[model samples]
Target: MFLFIRSLLKSPLAVGALVPSSPQLSRLIASQVCCGNSHVLEVGAGTGSITEALLNLGLPANRLFVIERDPSLVAHLYKRFPNIQVRCGDAEHAAAILCEEGISEVQTLISSLPISNLNGDNRIAILEGMMNALAVDGQLIQFTYTANCPFPAKRLGLHAERVGRVWMNIPPAVVWKFTRASYAL
Candidate 1:
């Protein structure tokens, strides 16, 4: 109850995205990438909307590492998803965080970040961070309201493929799956 308000204030953008992820979209994301018992790094975990979906899809809380920059939202997340390791920091520094956690690479990276809001440098940094931290065959799934890829996927040596779209979501969003150019298992 109280947490919802806090989430709203701290994450007006995220709040606008839809607090509870749609079942169909969640299932689509889970089916496209998430495999049982794999390490996943979730960025911009605002209000834990996607976090809820991830957990509901059977990814254990302990196996997931969430990174959020807002303190108030981070507090709210801690209260809601107590078992998750909530890092109150930027996702651009995910490489350092993953190393600190003794995680060599993550099998999947899920993001609810409003990449379209970020400038070129920051966007590139976040994308590069995720790419470098991802394991072989790892996948990055991100959602955006725009139909096109949020980042210059091809310029960055990433292959972007639209997995699905959720018109039921606020403003209607498209899910993009990013794989490294030379991705090999």
Candidate 2:
């Protein structure tokens, strides 16, 4: 908890929320996860609360990869989930980061990034990369404190749907799922 608070205080923009993701919100996000071997990329894995939930929900550790911008948080994640692949990079460079690792595509993306804190360009790049890297039937799950959709999926030519609302979280959050605009499944 001290680590989370210190990181949050050091970088408000990167951390976004004042607290780490609650187990309730994490489980809510995991409930939408599709069971498969395709890689699951988690953006902004702050202290890895959601990562734990993902693993508990049956996602294999080898198939799970996470990117955390803060070096401190990255170290913490590494210590927490030693078997999981954890990267230290910004969400905007997620595509390139995965490409460097020879992973061209992923099946699911679970993000806890504070898109509301990002500027338009950065946010778009992050969202666009996530959309492009996703498999055709892939789902991008994001939880936001606001009631509205944070990602401009419609503007980005993707379909967005509200999958769940986690009222148990401290600030309360809604999960939004996104897929390609033409994807029917």
Candidate 3:
């Protein structure tokens, strides 16, 4: 908790939430990952709450990769999940980070980023980078505190679905899943 609060105080925009993700929200986000051997990537892993949930769901540490912009949070994640690959970087460079880690694509990309708060260019860059790192049939699972879709899914030629909502969270959150439009049917 101290780590989260400290990180939040240090960078409100990057940390985004007053508290780390609630267990309900974490599980809900982790549930989006399909049962498979394919790789998984998580961005904005603040204190690794969702990352813990993902591991609890049986995702191998070796196959799970995480990117956190805050150096402190990145260090925390490294100490918390030493086996998992945790990088300190921006989500806009997720594709490059994955490539450096020798991951061409992931089956699921989970983001805890504050997408709605970012400006147009940053939002597009981050989302596009995420999409690029995802497999053709992969899914991007994101949560927001708003009722609306976090990103302009249709405008970006992506199919979006409101998967679930976790009202038990601090400010409550809605989960949305996005996939390439052509893959939707």
Candidate 4:
């Protein structure tokens, strides 16, 4: 909690939310990933709440990769989840990070990134990178506090669906799933 507050105070825009994700929201986000041997990537994992939920859902530590921009949070994640691969970097470079980690593609890409706070270019870059790192039929699961879609799904040639909403969270959260428009149709 202290780490989260320190990080939030250091950069409100980067941290985005005032409070860490609630367990309900975390489980809802983690539930999006289907059970299998497929690799999973989680971006902007703040304090690893959702990561814990993912692990609890049967995702192996070796197959779960996490990318957090905040060095402190990255360190926390590393110490908390010793078996998982935790990297400190920007989500816009997720594809490169995954490639450097020897991951060709992931079956599920879960993002806790604050897309609504990013500029147009950064949003596009991050979204494109995430899509590129995903398998052809892979799904991208994202949660936002707003009712609207966090990103321009159709403009990005992706199909979006509002999968779930967890009102028990701090400020509440809505989970959305995205996939290549063609594959989705």
Per-model C-alpha lDDT, please?
0.78, 0.86, 0.90, 0.91
TM-score of every candidate relative to the true structure = 0.86, 0.95, 0.97, 0.97
Clashing pairs in 3: none
Q: Which lDDT tens digits does candidate 2 get at residues 112-149?
A: 99888888888887888777767887888888888988
| Model 1 spans with C-alpha error above 4 angstroms | 1-24, 35-37
Instruction: Show how many residue pairs clash in every candidate, following the order shown.
Output: 0, 0, 0, 0
Clashing pairs in 1: none
Candidate 3 residue-wise lDDT, 1-185, digit = tens: 99999987887886788899999999988988983788899999989999999999888899899999989889899999999999999888898999997888898999999887888888888899899989998899999999998788888999999998899998899999999999976
Off by over 4 Å in 3: none
Over 1-185, each residue of candidate 1 has an lDDT whose tens digit, in order, gives 36656666676754445354566666666666555566898887767767887788778889988888878778888998999888888788887888888878888998878787778898798888877778868889988878888889878877788888888765677999998867723
- Please provide, for model 4 over 10-86, each residue's C-alpha lDDT reduced to its tens digit, 9 standing for 90 to 100: 99998999889999999988888973677899999989899999999888899999999999999999999999999
- What's the C-alpha lDDT at position 38 in model 1? 67
Which residue runs does candidate 4 get wrong by more than 4 Å?
A: none
**How well does candidate 3 score on lDDT at residue 126?**
86
